[model samples]
Target chain A: MDSSLGGILSPRAIRDDGASMRLTRTIGLAATLMLIAVGLVFLRAEQTRLAKATLALESEWVHLRGERWALQAQVARLRTPAQTRGRMAIFGVALDPPRPASPRTPLSRLALVP
Target chain B: MNTRVDVTQRRNGTVVLVGIALLLVALAGRIVHINWTLHEKLTGIADRQQSGSTIIPHRRGLIFDARGRMVAGSRLVPDVFVDPLLVGDVDALAQDLGARLNLDPGKLADGIRARAGRRFHVVARGVDEVTAKAVREMRNPAVGLTMRSARTYPLGASMAHVLGFVGRDGVGLEGIESWHNEHLSGRDGRRRTIRDAARRALHGVEGGAVRPVDGGHIVLTIDAEIQAAAERAVENAVAQFEAESGVAVVMSPKTGEVLAMVSWPTYDPNRFGESTPQQRRNRVVTDPTEPGSTFKPFLASGALADGVLSTTELIDCGMGRRYFGRRLVKDVSPHGLMDIKGIITKSSNIGMGIIAERMGDAALYDIMRRFGFGERLGIECPGEASGIVYPLRRWTSMSAASIAMGYEVAVTPIQLAAAFSAIVNDGVYVAPRLVKRLLTSDGTVLEQRNSRPPPRRVIPSDVARYMATELLVSVVANGSGWRAALDDYQVMGKTGTAKLPFADRKGYEPGAYLSLFMGAAPARDPQVVAVVMIRRPNPSIGYYGGQVSGPAVREILRETLAYLGVPPDGTVAMTAAYRSRPGL
Candidate 1:
């Protein structure tokens, strides 16, 4: 008689009830889909943030590049002959015509000596 | 009580159904109206707002001299614009900006006021960064700044004719700038971006964008220092002589590289518009002048080559005057009997007439054609004049005599220089070249130098040597070009003083002479071939090529040769610069 009662109240038979089993299966799937949706939302937010950051950086890069070129042009302008002649006043001496090397102690002779 | 409760429930259900139906009808009506009636207007608005693309202009090429000095380049500058809708205190703002930008305050104010009812106004097209920075500091809501690139010529008008200038639309207008405009102007880029209500680019939303490719750089054969030296000499000579114009060319005879070319009454390329069209013209490549006595050597070379004349053959100059084909041919100075060599040395017009008479027209024409005269010579620069060369059939009885004495033909200064360079280059002609190479922005060489044109063989080397040694060498040593002599350097050159023709092209203009000095240094193995020409100078200052242009050539050549450090040849005391060199 006890064996018969144990068989009737077994864990497998209680799990076989269709109404409760269906409810648990449906809940598990809904929870899984909800988690996946939550993950995707976070991923999209991160991607947008990165894209916006890259755009801002690119714009800044263009601005800085233009600035660098302008500075280079200015530097080149200052190095010109006209500018050099105009700015020679700080040295308190005028630029004279360039003189040639001394023939008495010639560079060719010096190079040949050693 | 149950019946009354059922009735209340039924009434509430009916009211709820009615409310739901009304909401559905209104939503459907709105959808139909928008799709059918308002499509075109909304689409147009959307296009104006979102479809427009912004251009990213490509930077124009940079021009570098032989020594890698930037002569012409582009720089990014701020262009000032205004939104009249957002403007405040236009006059006050104009005054504030005028002081910094060097603009007329009244003009700015007037323009700003005139722009009323307009949303946008170009206050200033291109402005320096410093002025733009000041404007930004003011933080005026009305003012807006856009970046634009402008061509900058740091050396100003030093090589303006070659470097050329950019138009307001950033296209090359003349010189190498125009010839290589395709390579100099790189492809512009573009991008699509979302703009806000204020039509400002949204940096957050980056979309389709094409990055600009900066233009290639051009490397010229011109040496900046040598160019400056040549220009200075020409400038001084022009001013001192009070001449209408002057041009000087310094070239490497072996390579046909034009190291320096200068024309007087020059204007700064920085302010190219202020220059007259005449000043803007590169006369070395454009204007052709009759070569006068310089034609003597080429004719001599031709005669000697054809065995029509020998080195020591004596010809009577008839006391500096002779009748050749009913024309009274006279020399600037009197001469008696002159050999082929003495003819060039004394620049005897009568002597040349005799040589030309013997050589005839066809052979002379063929030799001149080989010498690269009366032809373009096909240089890298633009606007080259071919000069006037009559056909063999067109030669008159007097044509040969006139041609021999450097008349009845016109030749550009560069053509004359290159032709003389041929004589210096061992009787071979090489076309004059300006640019050495073209380089990409990243320094990749896009185009190497132009291949040398086929070598033109004009005269035999032995004849060329005799002309260089016996004839041209004497011109500087003891002849008309004596003023161009250096104590320790053998100079081979000719002096030419030709009469300018009248506007009517009828007869020559009196008292208007074009004085020219062309020569090569260390004549034994020539290096630099230089030419100096002064046009329509005041006769009082001096009009003779020997006096006006020779001394100038000597000084220029002395400086250039010193800079070159080429060892001297002649047995004489050297200049300080040459003497100072390490070895004697």
Candidate 2:
């Protein structure tokens, strides 16, 4: 009889044990939800940072393309015949002007006296 | 009394609990309805706020001369515009823009005022790098800069007629530009991107981009060196003689490739708006003229081919003048009796008239048609004229004689050049070609799906060779075209001086003349055929084709032959058999 009494539990004690278990479960669920929310926010921030960097790089690429075309145009202009002739004149190798077929005839036979 | 109060308290607590439960139920139902019924709509709104599309600019093709020199290219330049409605302190804005763009501040302000309500206005177009940088540094929200691709011609006015020009809307308007616009203009690309709150593209979407296709490159058959020489010679000749205008065409007699074509009074295609339509005209292919004595060689060849006359056949030329069917046919000078060779050397009209009378109208017309006259040669240019060839049905009583004298027929300079090319190209008529090949942007030649037609035979090979080597050579060696003889090479050619007809078709212009010279060099094995035509030289200076146009042809040929490194042959002497004796 004593052993039986020793093994028996009170309703108040059982009620207290159940309440503690429920409290523990509720706290674990809340912690897991908080962690998931923090993970989502961090991922969003990283995506935005990467997008901004890519935008800057793309802008630079476009600018470089424009620069390339401008440089090509400049090089072509420098290689033109007129520019080459000008450079030749800068040195001592200028081309001679064409000589007329006949000696330039006198524009007037005689000048008028003042 | 206690029991009654307890019951009332229980009733009030029950009522409050019921109200709380009902409100919770309504909130849960509303959440379900939004998640299920409006899901797609809400997602679309979010995507609209985050993503957008942008166009990637395309690059037009490049044009290179045969020497691989870039004659035309495309460049990116900033085109600045203003939003007048967004402008603040208009006077300050104008002053800032004027200082950078070299515009009058007052005028700019007035322009802005005139467009106050408008959202957009052009501030400047195609600004250079320095000016564009200054405007960008201003950082004004009211101003905007659009990067546009513009065409650039490195050779400028030197190749204006061949390279043509592009319009403000990126459309080809003239010359090779218009002819090959489809191959030269590439397709623009589109990219789907995620945008920021300010409507700027942040990053591209995955698999959402359509890449641009760049235009193909064009290689022309024009030799820049030869082209420059021809232009210089023609320009100098026109200026020397004080002529109205001039034309020069240099072509490869072996391949019918036009090396250089220059039309005097040319305009700078870069500033085409400042020039007149007359200056922009490509007269080499578009203008027609009576060939005069130049037509005599063709007549003689046709008569020889028809078996009506032989090179050694003799006929009497009466006192420098004769009457054929009431048509008075006169020569520049009288000749007694001569064969076909002497008649060509002396350029006798009476001799040509007698030969044409024997051939009759049908035979003569057939010969002219076979020579590519009175028809478009199908050259790769715009507005090629089919020149007048009055058909056999339209012939009057005097048509045969007049046609033989080169009076009734009109031919373009290119047509005449091609006809002469046929004679020099060993009897084959090869159409003239300008473009050599097309290349992809990456430098791979495209397959030739549209090759030129094969050369066809028009005259016998032996007959064509004899005319170019024997008869035409004599004309330059001792005949009227002696002025066209070059010092290093043996030149074979003919001369023509024809009266210009009035525009109204009433009669010939008073004292107006067209002087022309057509020739080929290294007579035995010809290389290049050059034709020079001078329009309306001062009659006082010289109106004869031999005097005015011959020297220009000589200069062009001299430069071209020297550049080509053709070895000089000793002077060509007339053979004793073909030389005109005092009394043949």
DockQ of each: 0.25, 0.17
lDDT of 1 at B109: 83
Candidate 1 ranges beyond 4 A from true positions: A1-49, A83-114, B1-23, B32-55, B83-121, B137-143, B197-200, B204-206, B571-584
Q: What DockQ does predicted model 2 obtain?
A: 0.17
Best-matching candidate per TM-score: 1
What is the lDDT of every predicted structure here? 0.81, 0.83
lDDT of 1 by residue, B368-461 (tens): 8898888887777778899888898888899999998899988999989988888877888878889899999888998878626766678898
What's the lDDT of the predicted structure labeled candidate 1? 0.81
**Local accuracy of candidate 2 as per-residue lDDT tens digits, B55-83:** 56678888888778888888877888777
Q: Model 2 chain B, TM?
A: 0.87
How far does residue B423 in candidate 1 sit from its true spot (Å)?
1.0
User: Clashes in model 2: which pairs?
Assistant: none
**Would you list the clashing residue pairs of candidate 1?**
A101-B580, A101-B581, A102-B580, A106-B582, A107-B582
